[model samples]
Target: MAVTRPLLDLVNVTAGYGQTPVLFDVDMSVAEGEIACLLGRNGVGKTTLLRSIIGLNALTSGNIYFNDADITKAPTYKRARKGIAYIPQGREIIPYLTVLDNLKMGFSASGKKAKRIPAEIYDFFPMLKEHLQRQGGLLSGGQQQQLAIARGLMCNPKIILLDEPTEGIQPSIVQEIEDTLRRINIEKGITIIVVEQKIEFARKLAQQFFIMEKGAIVEKGKTDKLADSLLHRYLAV
Candidate 1:
């Protein structure tokens, strides 16, 4: 069931690295059980914005609220413990670790005694089950991406942030990932905030969208009502 309150809220957030600000006075919110998309071209601070949300990057000012808790200064591990899962752009699974081990790492964030791997995860990505013993570095790119996502799920997150999930991924696997995300949102009620450059992919999956340019939000609205002219102006090559 969707919570009445917004799952994630950023109020007047100003964040960056080492006195160099990448985001300025950015205010955004994602409602419970909704897919919110952050769309932008490369080098527009999209990644920086996501890193700020997860506490991977420092917030020079403002507050971040997750499930109504003030978490502006929370460490990355603390945020993960609070059920904020971040799937970064590069599918950075431990190359030497077996697929099973990487998945187990995700469960550590749950702070519970995990007796068994959730069957639902395998159901979502059957290939993972088949490659339980395989090393992460040995799998194909698509398979590695699936592993990365499965690892995040082990944390039992309330909301998942995906950054450029389709980057360098095969089309078929991209579709698989998209379908799984939709199912997770509909059935499990996991709220999602996806940072994507593919306009069609974002349009199909997001209920609401925010367009960023040069470190600021340039456009935002319901996905269905996203102005084509604005998209053209912001996204044209």
Candidate 2:
């Protein structure tokens, strides 16, 4: 179900913390409506790549194009407004806020006139609908992850960047998350770039894949063409 045209493109992107580079000349593209997975062992710059796309990490050298516009120099909030939603690692929903409020907070990034949470949001996460008044901190890890994804959708993003979504969840919820992500892509036409460590999950969820090592992309292709040898070389601990 991947679209042919690229929705997000990163060309020769090098980014990092102050005076220390983490991503090196990384070039990648996510086709419109495609689910692309970024895979690497710990400390291989997978998270940094996602951060770069969301504008949280500045590029030392490169160009990022989204919807055919250069946004490499844009600020984080501006990137969100430009329809890039980032769900960072740890499912960082405001702990004290009610679930409903957390979702409402997404409006700050969207700048949409409609202030009401769309009914479709609840349709996607009926569990959240049932717990609208509950505090975000009270949800289980899997539920919190769902809330994080749901909050991102409130902005009606064209693309969603997810970091380590399956890190701490149980197997059942992991399957649910995977199924939900696929449904989101097919039903909502949202492009997804997920930073993931689980090989099976990545293989099942992504149509395209990129594997990184020591801050640079070493391999990439359609997921169907991903060879086990590559995983053994780059992903083996």
CA-only RMSD, every prediction: 2.3, 2.7
> lDDT tens digits, residues 170-207, model 1?
99998998998999889889999999988888989999
TM-score of each: 0.95, 0.96
lDDT of each: 0.89, 0.92
Q: Model 1: which ten-residue window has the lowest total lDDT?
A: 1-10
lDDT of 2 by residue, 185-224 (tens): 9999999999999989999999999999999999999999
Q: Which stretches in model 1 have alpha-carbon errors above 4 Å?
A: 1-5
Cα shift from native, residue 192, model 1 (Å): 0.3
